[model samples]
Target: MARGFRLIFATSLLLMLLGICNGSTIGICYGRNADDLPTPEKAVELIKNLNINSVRIYDSNIQVLKAFANTGIELMIGIPNSDLLPFSQFQTNADTWLKNNILPYYPATKITYITVGAEVTEAPTNVSAMVVPAMTNVYTALRKAGLHRKIKVSTTHSLGVLSRSYPPSAGAFNSRHAGFLKPLLEFLAEKQSPFLVNTYPYYAYRDSSSNVSLDYALFESSSEVIDPNTGLLYTNMLDAQIDSIYFALMGLNFKTIKIMVTETGWPSKGSPKETAATPENAQTYNTNLIRHVINNTGTPAKPGEELDVYIFSLFNENRKPGLDSERNWGLYYPDQTSVYNIDFSGKGTVDVNTGGNLTTVNGTSWCIASPTASEKDLRNGLDWACGSGNVDCSPIQPSQPCFQPDSLVSHASYAFNSYYQQNGATDIACSFGGTGVNERFQPQVLIVYS
Candidate 1:
């Protein structure tokens, strides 16, 4: 029976064990904080022009929901923090909330995730107690409606939730938010819902330019930075930011939960001190980011795993508070003109299959750590391949064919090859902090005999 199961597993892989950790979705955050913005009807037309299929709205305004109906555009609508108290107080309240916002146009509107609140940790008041109950209440309500299995229920948190986010691997949530996050993470794990975070590398780069470079923040870095603790290669700030969140999640012992970027974008304008915020930089960041996510180029820590993201703000909000950047994150001006020219149309390009299985050419290339690198560096590279690289290392396990040689170099070679292949066999995927080298080594499929 065990041998049969192994055969089934390998067969499933050959048949393409993808789509789970593949092809990310790109969505726009349709914030309505501004007064001069177009009507929901007109906004829908603009969204359609972008040709992207997903959108996230801050509220369940009937007009917005109604306008989006039947367009087949997936919507992520939120419940504000103010409502969390009421929603968490009773199952009835959650049911009522959903009844008003969701039940009306859900199937037509294609609502996917119902976020309980927006950045509640950053809310003026500490409604920490209510976050989970609200999610539970909302989830229960969805369950009662037979929609729990269909739509996800969660909350959006800012990067403030993490006390440490550097080096990607050392990511840990603030102990202050630990109590709140523990139950919340559990709830999400049980429901199999995603952990939503408003990830902004702009904030990171803005505050710490010395630590965060312009090229890195805008996804334009020519060279990769190695995470000393994990040895994973981070080419851009966004991936490093997201991977930090992944590491933080891992710290909590919840590894399988998916992460969704509820909000992320660079601003075209900012306070003079926010020097990095320029039209050119904004365009570069978003353009590169859109292509990065849609291309299924997962983070250095989790290659080939899609982290579906929503670009913040479809239109700039004149009414938004704070610094200049707060009001300047839109892809379009209030008049609906392009803030800066960018192509948001091409969503993703990951091919599902390459047809039948085969030998050398079919598998083609392999990746391994450079033998010339120092032993310490080689160890880091190998560690990254087997660790954050998320490669299947069973072939290097005890008694396996590749396991015979035994030493770190051999095992590391096998791991790098697997990680390389799993990640589209790209040159960067082989880059275990610049210590990786690509070679035309063909991989043999794992075979077992009953």
Candidate 2:
């Protein structure tokens, strides 16, 4: 066997043994906001290559459901915001959605959870107000279909749902959001599904890096952020963020619900103004995060419970809106190459598409493309998967040195560029050959190969 394959097989066996020993579950969000991702079938192939056991998608896309069938991977599918209004009002709508989108694929897809809405507290529209009722209705529908026991219903909320989160003990929900969040918390507790949060230390850092320690947010080793009331020291921002949610739940009179971080990541690239965005920082954040999970490190508040975190994305999303950083949180480029190597234990042989010019590594053939096209064009060109659409890896420095620590975004931005230059209007220059998305015009690259 090839050395790489042997390494992969050994690693895979070790991972499987460790998973069995640890019995921890990890979930990844499969957001499809961009257009350059692989088809569901190919996505399944990619996911299998990663050996991730659980995954979450924004919607019950039939193709995704079908693609994942019989794979033994657990899925958590979403009910979009638009459909919430109708589903909340009409049981029939919920029933039809389940019958059409869920029932047929069941037992085959191994779907375990259904997220009724995403961060409803942060959703722009009334999707927040309708979430509880929508969840209830959806739960009822699942029950009617005799699938409620197997599938749990829940909704994700943003950290914005909290009124104060500084001291883990003093955490409380916003008065305004309480009316909506209380009932939802009850439903989750009743169903025993986790309370999900999309926590971003980046936002806090960007809002006020002066007050927020870059070290704390970036998972750098440092003195803990002490929660005065509890007198606990928090070594990582992710734990503090989650404990804040837990404390918020306590304030609402529901303290037992499990809290899970549904999404969290560091952007590998960003606009000039986004100081913390960089490849090196991204690597540190993810690498530390993986180590944290592997060690089963919990927040100071929840010392024993294992944290289940899905990094923001598998690939940098080229088409997401807002700052240039918004689109660059992926761990890989569209061609299934590592953006910067971190251990994922993703080595396997599979059928390759011979139709296109492809790079055959193992049995998988990945397309080699640069993210030279505009974000819109990339989105249009690729099927809309969160990390699939834009930005290229082909132009990066020597592919052989996949794990070169310096070329990463965090090091490139913070260590290489001056503080003034980080926030300056100077167009980003490529130390390597490729372009990363920035504010003015974000370019995306999507290459699809079986």
Q: Runs in model 1 with CA error above 4 Å?
A: 1-21, 346-450
Residue 106, model 1: Cα distance from true site in angstroms: 1.9
Task: Candidate 2: list runs displaced more than 4 Å.
Answer: 1-23, 345-450
**For residues 164-266, what per-residue lDDT tens digits would candidate 1 score against the true structure?**
9887899999998877889999998877788899888888888889888888888889999999997778889889888989999988888767889989999
Cα distance off (Å), candidate 1, residue 427:
16
| Per-residue lDDT of model 2, residues 1-450, tens digit only | 476554543332222212222233456677777878767787778888877878888899998899999999999889878788898898888888888999999999999889887877667676687888889889999899898888888888778888888877888888987678777777887776778888888788878888788788888956867777877788877778888887777677675566777788888888999878988888888777766765544566654344677777876667899989888888777766777876643222211233663323222111211235444443332222112322212112232112132223322222112211222323332122222232221222223322
Q: Give the Å error, residue 258, model 1.
A: 0.9
**What local distance difference test score does each model get?**
0.80, 0.65
Q: Which candidate is the best by lDDT?
A: 1
Clashing pairs in 1: none
